[model samples]
Target: MTSPALTKDAIRAKALELGFDAVGFAPATLDPKHGERLHAYLDDGRHGTMAWMESRAEQRISPDALWPDARTVIVLGTNYGPRTDPTAIHALKDRAAISVYAQGKDYHDVVKKRLKALGRWMVEELACQIKVFVDTAPVMEKPLAQMAGIGWQGKHTNVVSREFGSWLFLGEVFTTLDLEPDRAEVDHCGTCTACLDACPTGAITPYQMDARKCISYLTIEHKGTLDPDLMAAMGNHVYGCDDCLAACPWTKFTKLHTEPNFLPRVELTAPRLADLAALDDTEFRQVFAGSPIKRTRRNPMVRNVLIAIGNSKARRLKEVAEALSEDLNESVRETARWALQRLEKP
Candidate 1:
């Protein structure tokens, strides 16, 4: 068993060899007071229908509360920085704008596999007990990542690395081994309002975001019909929105991810919205097989497509929306109806 006194550089080097862009260590006992803002964000309904966040609020606030035996958190970062500007697709009225994060494989699967591999190495080399977690875990990863010196949390609430910009995906390994902690990263956002100014939905304000107004949440997390305000703000995004992330000036320093799995598929980079709108249940399944898009389910994807179709203000999409006006999913039908009203009938 490697001693708790193992040098931080050794472990970080191991993680970097594993293709992680950055790595840092922190004590598992993160301050509970650190989560007061999370409680406030949830209490204010800023999280929208992501009620599970509130349900796990207590555990999310205290990592020791989540895993009492855990004494160290090994925060690891993988840069998924896009090779191209993701926001450029928004101007393509006939295409669907998929968030860069989802343009490739499901990150949940890709990241979890790496976490497991790293955890196994820790168990074998350090002879330590460990637990691995990715985005789905109740753990609050962003703050912990900052505490580990991986990056600072941006105003948009996504972790931003000066090296990777807003394109880093975080995962953590909680270990029974007591390791030295890194100096926490501080807010480098300064007076810049690039993310705030670029947000079409005005979801970003200083250091907080209203998830109800976040297109990412509305399109991917919110299940039911979005209000007119949200619908109008969504523009042509069908899966998730990256306006705030793309607007970060730090992006200029980004080194494109070398991970083959994180690269965008040729067809998905900017798919024709009309083609996605035409998908039926079977075809939707076939199209998004093993992809993260299935998390929102086929109906919701279609629903988002309808909203984008409406927002495109394209006369050709009128028929596309019309075909979906009587969809089995009531919300999809409702959104299609709303879309129809936006298009010129003649």
Candidate 2:
């Protein structure tokens, strides 16, 4: 009832034809060393308040544990490299610096659509069972991507490609087909500490990250109020941070991504801190509709915007911070007070 098994080359060609920039096959099972590293990271409490990492440890470390029937993993990368310097917004003190990844339509929506297309192809052609995943799953995508030879996890702990640098969005398809695995990529980050040195909050060391101190984690994931020190270091990054990713030397080989869905939206690329800080729940939802920033919601986003306003030291925005000092959300109110105090300082 099924067509004959397709060659790895055929699948790779199909993925490219579907607009994926990188494709490779890897065994569904992960190397034990990778699992060990994850255990150690979780043990050290480096994941911050992301409790799912602890709860989902078993499924995340082993693909077999997640889906025992999976024999081959098809790793796919879509390029979302920025057309301009992503770090340039920092110099414009009043504007919020959103991470390059969040500047457009949500990647989960964009990447998953392609993954399902690829999955449907495999089912129709080989009659194989397949499961597709993007970041919505607990799969260790960066490690699996390295195993698939698409790229290696660099010193910053994000996968870096020779072709796309730090700009690839990873997704995977786990299937019953036993395709030949590609040679695992070796680390190309020798002696490079650019990502470490570039981190304003020192969240990274050689190849490890402490999410508690990461600006991206603080701005996007952490709930409630933030530490004053971390808030001060956040600069104008209101949604997500990109300093470490933008600092990678591997990015010299980066080419602008052609995907229109991943292109930066004009407003998100240079959102004014004052405008963002003033957004009500409904306004926030409307403005960030269809964007990743929508998940962040209003209170936390306003909290982050307040921190950026505090760091701005532009006394003109002091009244903006004061206006939110009595916000209904305790966290927003506290952050607004902090911003007001910081702005009042010399």
Candidate 3:
């Protein structure tokens, strides 16, 4: 086993060498205020349909609650910044606008594989016990990342890196080794309301968010027909919304990511809503193979596509929405009806 004094630097160097854009260390504990905010959010039903978040509330409050033996957390950030503006697709009402994060191969697979590699190295070299997590676990990654000094949580409630902007994919390595913690990052948002103002559905209010009103949550996590007002506010976002992230001024410092795994696929960049509406279950699975969008599955995907079609004023997509009026899923069928009704209006 290596000396305890050398572990922190060694781990940081190894993580950077392994393609992580940013790395930081934080203790296993969390501030009381974070827990209080989480409880308040949950009590207010801000998490919406995500019941799992509530199930693991205590564990998510502090890393120690999840693993008492964990002495420190190693946070990793991978930059997936886009070459083009993510919000630009909103202008092309006939095209489907998938979120920038979902435009490539699934980030969970990419970030987790790298995290496992780092965990294995720590176990082999430093003889430390470790567990790795991507988004699947009950970890509070954003707050932990902020505490580790990788970035601050912006007013939009997503991490904003000074160097990588709003484009980081986060994962964590919890270890028994007690490494020195990095100074926590201070909030740099400073009176900037760009993210809040960019929200189409008024889901964001400074640092807090109502997931029920968020387009990203509505299109992905939501399991039923959406409110007509929210559907109209969603614009052409068929998968996830990037309006708040794109509006952040910090993004100006980020360069396009060169990672092959994160580069946007041509088909997802700006697909025709008509083409997306025509994707049957098998075709939906095939097109989104190895993508995060596949997790949303065909039913909800079709439902979201139908909503986008409704918001699109293009007369050409009217028939596309009509064909799905009797879709097997009630949400899809309802959204299709809404789309037909919307398209019929002048």
Once model 1 is optimally superposed onto the true structure by TM-score, how far is the C-alpha of residue 21 displaced, in angstroms? 1.1
Q: Which stretches of candidate 3 lie over 4 Å from their true place?
A: 1-5
lDDT of 3 by residue, 150-242 (tens): 999999999999999999999999999998889999999998999999999999998899999999999889898889999988888889899
The residue pairs found clashing in candidate 1 are: none
RMSD each, Å: 1.5, 1.6, 1.0
Off by over 4 Å in 1: 1-7
For every model shown, the clashing-pair count is 0, 0, 0
In candidate 2, what are the lDDT values of residues 1-346, reduced to their tens digit? 2322456877888899999999988999988887899999999999999998989999999888899999999999999989898898899998998999998999999899999999999899777899999987989999899989999999899999999999999999999997788999999998989999999998998889999999889988899999999889889999888899899999999989999998888899898899998899999999999999999999999999999999999999998999999999999999999999999999
Minimum summed lDDT over a 10-residue window in model 3 is located at: 1-10
Q: Model 2's lDDT to the true fold?
A: 0.92
Off by over 4 Å in 2: 1-6
